[model samples]
Target chain A: MTDNQRLYWRATRRLTVGLLLVWFAVSFGAGILFREALDAASIGGAPLGFWMAQQGSIYVFVLLIVIYCTAMTRLERKFGIDQKGSDQ
Target chain B: MSGPLWSWVFVGLTFALYIGIAVWSRAGSTRDFYVAGHDVPPVLNGMATAADWMSAASFLSMAGLIAFLGYGGSVYLMGWTGGYVLLALLLAPYLREFGKFTVPDFVGDRYDSRAARIIAVICALFVSFTYIAGQMKGVGVAFSAFLDVPQNWGIAIGMAIVLVYAVLGGMKGITYTQVAQYVVLIFAYTVPAIFISLAITGQLVPQIGFTSESVLPRLDRLLVELGFTEYTQTTKAKIDVFCITAALMFGTAGLPHVIIRFFTVENAQAARRSAGWALAFIAVLYTTAPAVGAFARINFIDQVNETAIDDLPAWFETWESTGYIDLDDKNGDGVVQYRAGADNEVVPNRDIFVLANPQIAGLPAWVVGLVVAGGMAAALSTAAGLLMVISSAVSHDLMRMTFRPDMTDKQELRWARISAAGAVVAAGLLGIFADNLGFVAQVVAFAFGLAAASLFPVIVLGIFWGRFNKQGAIAAMVTGLVTTFSYIVWFKFVDPDPAGWWLGISPEGIGFAFMWLALAVGVLTAVATPAPPDHIRQLVEDIRIPGAN
Candidate 1:
């Protein structure tokens, strides 16, 4: 693997980890732990905490995956690792 | 005669449509059977995966669980959907690029050991069987409730339908049928919710309706006045909640049925795209669930308390007489008061809250029929998906790979169909055996814990750590299996009830904790051992490359 390849992989790793962190925070963080604090805040007449636990976190999760997918396809193209059969 | 007849008509029509699709799209070759010939468009795959992922538990049990547990139940809603983030980002792409048939194929090829694949086969079977038990019985319940038939007969009918499509079509057929199921289920799920939301908050959307202004100011004030939490209030134990959420998150990424959906797509990028699409599709349902749960809880309490019990609406009287809803005037007050905590006197059956919500909230009968149809779709789609995977594992992984390497592709396809029929029969038997089991949610959680404990760690280590060998994967799987299984068995049978248990946490919640511990120990043993051979390294490289021909 060359420098370009290494850079590509590193970028991919960061993007993956970043998405996972948000996934953890929204679901385990806002949805579960801080739900009461969130309840104090309001969204569309519903408490923020209640909304996050049920709906908001899930919406964020879908967005996170779409973001990751967009980021990875770019990374794959940059590293010349775009889907292709190995020349074995 | 009214509701049950409509349910049968809707359910029966939906089943016929699925059978029609399966017959039309049945796979011809081994590749077609295995990966749907890798031609499935991303959007179609997304719909199929949604149906495959949403199971009886998600459809029949999740909102009911949330209705009871309040904020704690968000773990399931978030955890299950959030898992696709992991799948889209890390797992699906590489696995699709690897282009093999099953997860065990990835394990076996990556580790360059037949032993690794064998271990995976065991884990998949274990997970599938546990999952199937709950789903099969769910079919029985739905049948008994909506069709006015015996539970055993219901299971037999469901088993027959699944066997027909799963055996005839394989992955290709199952994929298209799953898409049809997704449409039926989503329509079924949202229609009643819309009516319930309108009735409760005058908001069209359930999510918005949950937070909208209440019809009765006094009722809202009463909730706050009586030390009862507000309808929108969120409350949960944080740390234990964290563990439960994490287990579900990882468990979702680890489920075989969900992962195999990616295999049906054309490329790694499409796999990732499809994962995103799946999350979006799944989110629509997940978000609606809490609103439905919250609104249903509020509406139910109000109805039971204020409606003078005798004139408690036609739906209630109907379900009550049918033994579905049991309402007791404990204090002779003739009103139902629903408060949090175990000590709360009024305890509505959790299952009835969501299933009967359409009727409970005065929705149209047609809408109620749709909800029943939706629940059946969820149960049937998932059951078929599980059956396909189990059968493929038997025919492809076990027989073709190990016993008869020279077997023709034609021979393999035939065996695959046979295996599917056999698996359906076996699952039907298990359903009959566990018919009188406890809550649906509890049984499903046990299966998730089993997947988390037995498969997640082994697969993760094998993919990322070069030192992970066949022995390590095998040992980890076995350790996780034994620990998780025994803990559940002990809690269910030997240990005292939840209140008497060590932590006051129930068996359903505690079983996964034991599984994680076993996974940790097993992975460590693998790390302390030797590296796999060059072929294993090659396999890893193969999976990593975008185009590996």
Candidate 2:
């Protein structure tokens, strides 16, 4: 495979893994199993579990994807991938 | 709450704004009508997609489901958002790369058959209609709760509003309006939750507050003492739980309204980015759902229980009067406790939690007004998006593709507008006639099941497997629809027992399982018969290149 192809694959794979980890941490870890345990931690005067389930996790998800988009765009440029439409 | 003549004025202004936005962003051509001319920014597409997706079900029903179901209900939190991962990684890029005007267009070209497109159109209609009926009802419920109007009138007004915007702007108008709706809904959903969390648990965030030790220690223990599972435990049966989660996950991915969002982006790469962005946006609402659900359940119980029946707060009396909430106080104790399973004697409508949040949290009138607007945003936004999908499929996919190939773009656009209006009228009538179609969640679930069964298989096979033919696509789609619809009917009305065992599973799960089976069988039969020609592979190659346009 070309270096560009390899770079694209690696960047996507890493981001996917990272996103999944955060997803698991918030939904499964904080939401289900360790909910009470995390409640021990507090955010904005709220317990960690409640915060994670309601607001914090969602905030994290949005930030995570924004990061992914930025990084992926950088990857595209590095690999000489031109994604812009010529139609316009 | 009554002093809000100004609130009503604000609502009028919001409505006018929506109409203005629709007119301003109206699609100019067939390409714009179909895919917003594929110039939408990834983030904007993401936001629009999120608004389109987080319907009355997500905005209104989900938090209550999580609150009642507890840990088992986390399935929605996981299942719906998790599917985005699947979409981004497995589906979005590929589908976007293979750019087509409609989902049926993809299926037809990929399978090298017009018959496939026809079958796809039917499935999309079934899916869109089943889902749209519930959205219209949701708008009525929201209006009735906050605006103090009769539900039938609320539904009619809601239908008219959706028709105006959707028919006028098509995809472009719908896209921009959805972004506004997403902002309104997310804010409306979280603000009350935060206040309630602080009140009950001394926490600002509802998500964390549910998990934290209760601010009132006795309340937590009391929940466990009253034959209720721990606030954090999973009490539901594993099999049923798994099935519900799987169906919701697959259903989200399969839904035509949601899938069509990808087409708005310029190319496959943008589509991938948009999917990620949409999920991220959706996650904000989804993750909070469980927290809101749990916190509402706890707070609601805390307020009602141990209080005298006559003294059980003014809102309860009002809610009871409206038939939205009922309190029997079965043990003759003034307090009400809600438990899982069908047998649980105490029942409260899940829809009320979000609607009642302002009163429950003791927020100001303005906040309550905001909630009203938010609920409208959720209901109307989804309704408008679905109307566009249903209408476009009718005019473009079925009419133009099949009946009137010679029709100009201008003529087609007119038909599309007419179709949008007709769909809204139909939905309004259905909402009026099926007055007892109570929960939006159940109705939306039926739509999801229909989509999963019928369209998902055809879409998947047509894209990946080159050998799939028209005959196979038709057979698969029909089989899927029949199996799913039959399962739903048999369970909903015919038996409701589900004990005699068609694979020892309940009816809801059976729909999804049958869908997968039908798809497999359809593909196998197609493969066994004959090889597809070279054009099929060529179509695949065309969709693969990033600069297809």
Interface DockQ per candidate: 0.61, 0.23
The TM-score values for the models, in the order shown, are 0.93, 0.87
Error of 2 at B39 (Å): 1.4
Model 1: which residue pairs collide? A45-B211, A46-B211, A84-B546, A84-B547, A85-B547, A86-B547, A86-B548, A86-B549
Q: Looking at model 1 chain B, which ten-residue stretch has the lowest summed lDDT?
A: B213-222
At residue B234, candidate 2 shows an lDDT of 64
Against the unseen true structure, what C-alpha lDDT does each candidate score?
0.77, 0.73
List model 2 lDDT by residue over B255-344, tens digit each.
Answer: 778888888888777887898889878877776677677677777777776667767777677677878776666665555645444424
Error of 1 at B509 (Å): 4.4
Candidate 1 per-residue lDDT over residues B1-549, each given as its tens digit? 477677878888898898899889978888888888898999999999999999988998889877766666777887788778878877887788778889888877876778878878987887787788788888888888877889999999989888878887889888999999999999899888888887777789877776665622333465665456654443444555666676677778888888888998888778889998888888889888877877766776667654566667776777777776666665666655455443244456687776888887876666767787888889889998888779989999999997899999999999998899899999999888876565444566667777777777777676566577777777777787787777677777677465564454455555457556766776677778887787776666556556754
Fraction of native contacts under 8 Å reproduced by each candidate: 0.77, 0.19
CA RMSD of all predictions? 2.8, 4.1
Error of 2 at B81 (Å): 1.7
